[model samples]
Target chain A: MLARLRWTEFGRDPGAAIARARLISTLGPLIALLLASIFFSIRTDRFLTTENLSLITQQVAVVGVLAIGQTLIILTAGVDLSCGAVMAFGTIVMTKLAVTHGVNPFLAIALGIGVCLGFGVLNGLLVTVLRLPPFIVTLGTLNIAFALTHITSNEETIANLPDPVVFFGNTFRFAGTTITYGSVLAVALTLITWFVLTKTVGGRHVYATGNNPDAARLAGVRTRRVLLAVYATAGLLYGIAALVLVGRTGVGDPQAGQSANLDSITAVVVGGTSLFGGRGSVLGTLVGTLIVGIFRNGLQLLGVAAIYQFLITGVLVILAVAVDQLSRRRQA
Target chain B: MSAVAARVPVLEARGLVKHYGVVTALDGADFDLYPGEILALIGDNGAGKSTLIKALSGAIVPDRGEIFLNGTPVHFRNPLEARRNGIETVYQDLALAPALDIAENLFLGRELRRRDIIGIVLRVTDRPRMLREARAHIADLKINVGSMKQSVETLSGGQRQGVAVARAAAFASRVVIMDEPTAALGVRESGMVLDLIREVRARGTPVVLISHNMPQVFEIADRLHVMRLGRRVATITPASHSMTEAVALMTGAASSQGPTKG
Candidate 1:
């Protein structure tokens, strides 16, 4: 529908050329994902099976949710290095309250999300009020969240979570293949976020703020408020990611998600969202997350070493960013 | 033109005093903008012309001053407040989000929301309505940017200026203050902006234009407000003063003939 609208409006509008270019850019990640899947399928019959495909979706659930939040932050030309640690802290809070502190399961979940929201607000206040660089502020909060997670959980893993906490982790059969509710939630959240970003006033402000903050401010956008809302909203998404994490692992492990910060960022960049901000889409991010999942699954199926996967992922990230820079230069 | 002076000023400022910690940017500046006239504010680089304009447009709060809109004292806490009172300013930088389309830029801060449940619940903007209105606004100003959907960055320097001016003209019911609207444009583009200013005045909105381009100022402005040493030194009409005399008054080389009045 969007493409049709663009094409219909293309008459007598020279801007259609640029709009076409953007459409191609958005499709870039999906193309890469399809090609990668084809290569893996050709290499190993196991790669094409429903079992392995469902496994990939299950594996991507947590990181997929994390990437949603990451996409929002990166859209504002900001990065949240604390997202992974914040999710870990939230998971611990939820599990500890329910299992150890005997808090109501629903209240425990809300409190966990609230704690994550608080951190987001704190990050926002420091960035807007003190006017600190986002990199430095998030870096500080990253360490703070990491420390708090360990302190609260006592460097231990909490298992046997209540039913409500583990609800999303449970599997349901769909078309003869098992699917986790967490995966559905991740995809749902992505669509909701995409709607909010594309169809609302707040979404436009996010793009405007990222594109040129001074201009946005002069145009009557309360840019500081926009930034604050973005950080706070991203933080809330991270807390939801924590729930997905607990569901998948069935344990609140303090040591989990140590590499998640970089992983989620990798997904966003690979999905074709610009790290410079204001130009990418969450739908692209969905493709990006799958791309990462496919590569890891494909490599493992092909008997590549676990360590080799890290090397390949690193190379992919740099390549994606290089493509972004080249395209930006061309636009300039 | 003489009858305009007898009417109450649409926008007026008295003794606007602003200091920046050991440096006074605006020292007791007084300004008056009458209805349906182009008042060009001209001053040298450090003569505090921008500072005085900022105070009136709500970009900065003056330490000591009173501003009146339609004879009613008004204090603007920010640019949005000024805008709510029917005053708009086009900053020197143009303040345009380059990645956003011209229609989006026109409705950047003050987007129109849909009136239905979709808008009420989801807060979805009335994008189609905004696009229609934006096209009308741009067309009314006779700007030929081709498409309202094109991002501002894709437009040429002159086209961007047209977008900025058109925005001010569309929303400003009482006054439009433009700070060097043509400083970055080519000669042809500058002339187009001067025409835009004239078109704005034709619609009965008074304009407060800040320009260093003396010829353009004299060509379009009805009255010239010359600032020197952080205050209005003289208010002269093009009929009464030459370009050389305006420059001299702006640089403190020539003294006013008498106490300055609007």
Candidate 2:
């Protein structure tokens, strides 16, 4: 009788239904990724080669890493407009310190990372302490970081980077797959971020703060500190992305991260991570980055105009957010 | 009053005064809660019951007052401080993360870590232990939640209230202050909450229940503290007054009866 009435499993949890809905939300993007790949492969012979696939990974790695950081920020219901600018300023500082000033390569990189992290700290302070909107603070920092990059680098590209600076661009051939260490870095960072979000108490706090800051505070969470840590962590990720940028370009270009802010955000949303925050994953972000890369490569192969290519990508991002909102509304 | 009660109360607020510009939320409110007792606080609308609970829970700082935990004067600058001092509150809004599961909600601030060396090196949570313990804990409340993994957002209103009450019951060592725990609950769910309150009191933790529901106030409460305007007017037992007498006291239709001098 006790065995019959046992509540170990009430058949299936009603939550399974909600979980299924979430799975469908993520699967929509995955299917889109697969379809885009198929569409590109059939249209052109050049799109399917292992060499081209490796190149796409290379193109997306920096943005993917940035998106990983942006994913954390967005998970806390904040956006980082200065991400690309942080990377750009980072590249300038790194190259200028190592090449022009002849600082130690490692020290130069550390300084560059420090510079990027500072923007995050500043962003955190403005948002938490000053109670400023994240969008405005990051926008101001984006202009500031961009201007600093220009002024610091004399609006010029620093060339003839050291061999160690472009070390991430070093490639290894595995069968037909040409793998760059930068791609490995992106994957590693994403996995590490995934572990933090899913396994740690602090990770849970991040979700709580984003889900409802007032509730989080009442529940005894230090919300301001959580927000500060998230913004700072994102800054650190941008700094790391700057390293990848240097490796890929093999030169310190102040203009390298110009398009990254929007691109990274697009990747994050496409990955099924919600802009509303407290609902998304780093793994989904990686897929979103891949989708963007595949579309860009395919559109180029189809001889699509740069403007039209731009229009298509922008439309896809908007469409993804629209779908996300619709699904969220239904759930609510 | 028992010997321990006469010595020192579990939780006490002495002459708490709070103001919002021209309006006074709590004006010289004096409150006391003894260990292993359910002290029901009921008042008319805007009678400072919430303001008093807020001061006790560290949700708001009183303009001028002092709170004592086990007779030691405590200054709670924030809710975290109050929690550290063993004061947990279940607000009317049920401060829970909607996306997180039940186990996560139960262990939100003070999550248990793993026991082995891997736990020492890494900050990974003890998920299995948390789930097992949360299951047993919520089971103690006799709530029929489908799964420990279910997000609080997926829960019915009653289940959500159950989670909030369970969280407070599990953590609160000194006192648990609940603000209208059964406000939105149906008849059965509200009954469950009252039972939970009794169970909490049975565990020897003092409970300050703030509710507008008079029958509920009378049913579970060992003693009732009636508030009018901004001051506690009377402290009566279920046997001391009928429901109509309590209503009359609250609306000021009858003269205030001060706490009976023993």
Candidate 3:
């Protein structure tokens, strides 16, 4: 029945060849991004400025790193809802140790990251070993991590961190624009993600596991291990995002990461990565993050209201998913 | 049995038994496949044909039974172990990852890494070599795929089946087992698969075909093993028994001809 359906769909022509069909499905968001950029530039003189572009990069750095982790998990047909909560928790650990306890800055950062890694491992164990649904596992962890953040810090923000905690916030001028090391770190991390997912056998296995896990097992992939490792690494990325958060704000704020989880997902979806998994790229996720960043920066420059900004972002996400679904249906 | 039936069997299973809760999927089933011949395993619903093949393919473990390859006793804990032992199965679903390229699927689990330092340090796949070798293999199989770079999901049914069989034929040093290879295909695509099975035999490896299509089975299989009620009730030659007689034997109408223990 599946073969017959496919055959009839081909006979119908549908006005698109296979190669064009593939290209259009994958590149539709990219073209939209270009059009959005053009429209924004026409409306505002500052939109295409080097300073504004670097500012957009700086604003998106934390989400960019978090989205990399999200992309990996999504590639394996999983999601990480606890990333924002986990990041907030990691920041508390780092700030409390570095300021409240007067611990070494590096050691404090390590402890902060350790807590995030623990959450990641717990998510992985629950999903892979216990065979729990990923959605439920991560949902439960998100709340647990959030509650832990408040209990650990007693709902207090740690301020006045040392210089080392703010190292990533260090800036250098290039081509008449100030660029933070954090943005560079985000780019470097995205490149690493692209290489790992594209070049290595493990990366291919991730795609395979997402595409058809039983087939992957038949082909001898350790799918459980792959999923577990992806979760653990995502936790590590959350930890990194925490430090970037500290660099940007210069204070350990527990209330800060509430929007991060939603934002990172928005970026991932906007970049063309599918929630269905197995057919997206990390670089596309980077583009997604930029799209989110550009839209926010553009809307703010145009003096749009906060409620309208939120509504627009929500609509964009839904539209992107609808486009993806329609394209896939057309292929079928 | 062929003229050289006395020679060592490539793969043999003895008294394989499996129980799924209260259901007995296989009961004291036995099978043997000699080299360079196609053995068709046919049965009605729930007659343990799949169970027996699962034991051989390492998809299922029998409660009691032993398997031997080339007269050496072997125990396969999973499908990977079975693959390493030179046993590959093309399941009824044609277990191929739809999003991956043909070259990637052809070497899915056993990708060839670069020989230089990058392979050791970074572990990059040697794409150039695998693509070239995969193209040659596909051409050798006479599979009319558009490109090795195309994902398997885009190929037609006959082409995809050909790829699956060719994958097994390329890797199976001892035997290839296909479970319902033609069940989902139309008549033309089924013909393509039948030809591929013949090509596999011609390439010097034996095939164990588990299919329900009687005409397709009779056309390719050199021998037939029939099962009923989770047991092997008959092993007959299609040349000797008519299709109706085979169906009657499987449906419990005709008297069981071969050894019950076999």
Q: Which candidate achieves the best TM-score against the true structure?
A: 3
Badly placed stretches (over 4 Å) of model 3 are A1-18, B1-3, B259-262
**Candidate-wise lDDT, in order:** 0.89, 0.86, 0.86
Tens-place lDDT per residue, model 2, B1-262, is 2314456788888889999999999988888888788889988999999989988988889999888888889998878889888888998875788878899999987888888875667778899999999999898777677679887877766677878989998888898999998998778668767877888888778899999999888888888888888888887788788889888988998778644512
Give the C-alpha miss distance for residue A243 in model 1, angstroms.
Answer: 0.8
Compute the lDDT for candidate 1.
0.89
What DockQ do the predictions score, one after another?
A: 0.42, 0.47, 0.45
Tell me each candidate's TM-score.
0.94, 0.93, 0.96
The list of candidate 1 runs beyond 4 A from truth reads A1-21, B1-3, B258-262
True contacts kept of 1: 0.57
Tens-digit lDDT string for candidate 1 (B96-192): 9878998999999998999999898888999999999999999898777777888886666777888999999999999999999999877866877
The top-ranked prediction according to lDDT is 1
Error of 1 at B122 (Å): 2.5
Worst 10 residues of 2 chain A by lDDT: A2-11
The predicted structure with the larger DockQ, 1 or 3, is 3
